[model samples]
Target: MADRIVVAGVPVDTRHWIGGRRVASVETFTDHSPVDGQPIGEIARGGPAEAVAAVAAARDAFPAWAATPRAERARILHAIADGVDKRVEELAIVETTDNGALLRSHRRGVMPRVAHNFRFFADWLLRLDHDDFETRGHTNHVSWDPAGPCVLITPWNAPLMLATWKVAPALAAGNTVVLKPAEWSPLTASLLADIAAEAGLPAGVLNVVQGYGAEVGDALTSHPDVRRISFTGSVPTARRIAASAAANLTPLSLELGGKSPLLVFADADLELAVELAVEQYDNAGQVCLAGTRLLVEESVASEFTRRFVEKAAALTQGDPRDEGTDIGPNIHPRQLEKIDGFVQRALGAGARAVIGGRRKGGQYYEPTLLTHVA
Candidate 1:
């Protein structure tokens, strides 16, 4: 098992970044690549102790960070964005290896968006649209204030990009953030911590704790010092965090997974409809916002399904590093099994598979399309 991967001449750091320093954990977990189920490195297995330390750090740093001028904060954010842009290729490769997404998509789309998240929010912060009015010759003003010590819990599917979506705004608003990236895909988050530190971000202004949601997540959300909680993941986990945060009355923002459908009208262009249907397989169908179900007008359903299946069948699944590979392995064996279970149950219920209905090998699942349902 490799301790860490060297990407673009840098040995990836896998330790927790707390108080602007790398902190080691007594207990650690082995991070495995979704591409081949191979061990990529050993990551610090943070728990309540680490979570408490991180929150304390954020709380200690909150006053100074919140008091920092908006202009200065924006400058630091822009610097962070510059760092991210410079390391896009490295981050993209690390993310693709850690989470098993398409390398090309990460390089061309997701990683760039990660940097953009910081840059856009930084500029927006300087352009505050505070409401002001004059009443009876007296001036009244409403302005936004920083909420201190925010906790951000991001999902494994698109770890860095989604984490930054929450991190950027919270930091831009002059709040200190403690980010807990999903245990399954933690490499890029660690990388981001390094980037922010190098960009001159104040110590403890941004901290990262890497561990399972059940352990570290519970600790961070439940901590009283945390003023806000932002999470992106499943509904059940969101519920747990909400319950934990209720004691402190901490403000919460939750982005949970929901079933999405693609509706195709009879008049829709056949080619475009088929293209949209095939897109459901993007990210190996792991995306929470993916259109998992298709509702097509019966008049063109047969032709649409035919083209969709043909396209799905033609997708090449292999190692994510390969430029020719379209689809990559599922993030883990358990997720692969879960997908197969869904397809098997559908087939058992009389749904007929038009394209794929079985596992190919290892962590790869067939891009299945089923019809003739009840």
Candidate 2:
């Protein structure tokens, strides 16, 4: 392993944020930068015991948070949003260094959306309306109530943005949260805990536990005190979490995998279609919503393929920190191998490569285009 390099200006201790404080763990794991396979720092390796502690903290905080006025919750949420906005550059750097995401993408796209999530939910809570109905001899009423302590398990691909997607609404609804960010990309989530504290989020309102899913995730999902579980990740993992939550009759909100297809019609703008197709290669084509499958009208297929291949071939792949770098390394060497294996299998099964179709180096895969694919 490359020599461990602690990130300057950020907490190196990857302790769990429980009850408004940092808690230590029994073991530790080294977090390495996927960009160049160098050690970033060591993170606390938590297990079921840590998960139980986090859940307990959130459960203890739920009643008070749930009773807080909607307007008050909105104010705190907005403050958190502002705090995130002020630290966008710093968070983006951490995300890039830990997860192999391009700093440019995180700074300009991901971080802004993360802040927007909080802001949007903050305003949304205030706009909520109640409904009542009166009949000849009966009355009906509808209301929204807090769901108590919730477990939010975010994926590695877009750790901070997706975590906020779950965290913002949960907090806006006055529910305490136990967030278990994917172990591969926990740095930004750790920073978020600090931001929440700085924004004056009450003790135990938001707790973060860092560790592998099998240990921390299993414990959280199965904990009886956790009322709701929100997860975003692969379908297989979602299934496992679902089964575990089912044992406790817990409510679940899962956003699983997708193989999004891009359709191009003869009347559609060719340039625009080509551009959209090129986007499938973004984030090294690791995105769940990427348009990996293309369905084009036979009339425009030839032109679209030609232009798409030309554009895909021109994309720059290098260090994620570079200002001009278009694509960064994969999340790790294993993911790189997986992408390569899939392409090679397709090619062997009859698919033909029109342009780039090879690995660049240790963790970089070329922007690939394949035709006649089954």
Candidate 3:
């Protein structure tokens, strides 16, 4: 396989990682960066065939990986963490270019968490215990075992961070993984495949199939041989995956989207409340857990909203790679349009945006605050 290469100022290995090796597809899709709507790289467009192959590879590697000692697994995981630390900058840059998240946020927070995920799980694995209980002069012991091959379908918002959140625990518990990253931001996940290989992990233990969810994702979740499935995305898509996995009775863990709200009382600190409110715009309001809806006490609602709009309007919206930028472009034009639709609908109903309600340009949407949303 060729060494990692840079395209359009982004480092990428735009191929499917199957059986611990980089494999290219006959057909490829160009990934355009949301930063400036420029081509970042051409990624292998894997379909059902690639998904099946990846699952088979994971199934093949499962026995040896499951039987491997817990200490050995911990060591390998630590090595993977080290690899992530070494290439944190490159990974951050690739994610920023691919997804238009703030580069500083990725460098300082998200990338570090990726490495930390591995290390945390590695340590946790060593600390895990089997418990025994005595009842009526009899003793019963309980233990856990590897569940077999797992399929991890991660979102694009925070690709490596979320992928590793699932990957670390699954691998640490001795189950091989077949990760299907969201198509919008797959570059960092590809980088992680390389890091795992270099960390001395065995072949077929980790596989990546990159493509649209309908093709690769459906193949993975619906596969008969899959033992477990973990997905983080929308409720509608989760429903689809659940239906697919039902055929095999596969165990599934899902983390879906919600309208998280932040509440502030009349006596609360106004400035701090305003700060937290503005933080909802972090990652250009793409954060799944962000408090998108704010509920303030009517007594202080006017003051809090005033400060929030002032701060939000002053936020820097520009290229993600720029250090001065606070908010980056939306992940894709379609996502931008969806956000606009929501804002417009709110306006049509009766609400008004005190700060912003329009797209700045290209993929950048203004930091908007809507009042009279009740």
How many pairs collide in each candidate, listed in order?
Answer: 0, 0, 0
lDDT of 3 at 289: 93
lDDT of 2 by residue, 242-305 (tens): 9999999999999987887899999999999899889887888889899889999999899998
> For each candidate, what is the lDDT?
0.90, 0.89, 0.92
Question: Using lDDT as the measure, which candidate wins?
Answer: 3
Ranking by lDDT: 3, 1, 2
**Candidate 2 CA-lDDT value:** 0.89
Among the numbered candidates, top TM-score falls to 3
lDDT at residue 332 of model 1 (Cα atoms): 89
Candidate 1, run of 10 with poorest lDDT: 1-10
Per-residue alpha-carbon lDDT of candidate 3 for residues 1-374, written as tens digits (9 for 90 to 100): 33355954656688899998888888777788999998776789999999999999999999999999999999999999999999988888988888999999989999999999999999999999977989999999887699999999999899999999999999999999999999998888888998999999999999999999988899999999999999999999999999999998999999997897999999999999999989999999998999999999999998888788778777888988999999999999999999999999999999988888998999999898888997
lDDT, candidate 1, 1-374, per-residue tens: 24456743567877789999988888888889888888887899999999999999999999999999999999999999999999988998888888999989999999989989999999999898867899999999988899899999999999999999999999999999999998889999989998999999999999999988888889999999999999998888989999999988998999998887899999999898788778878888899988888889999998888788777778888888899988888998889888999999999999999888999998998788889876
RMSD of each: 1.6, 2.0, 1.5
> Where does candidate 3 clash, by residue pair?
none
- Give, for candidate 3, the lowest lDDT window spanning 10 residues: 1-10
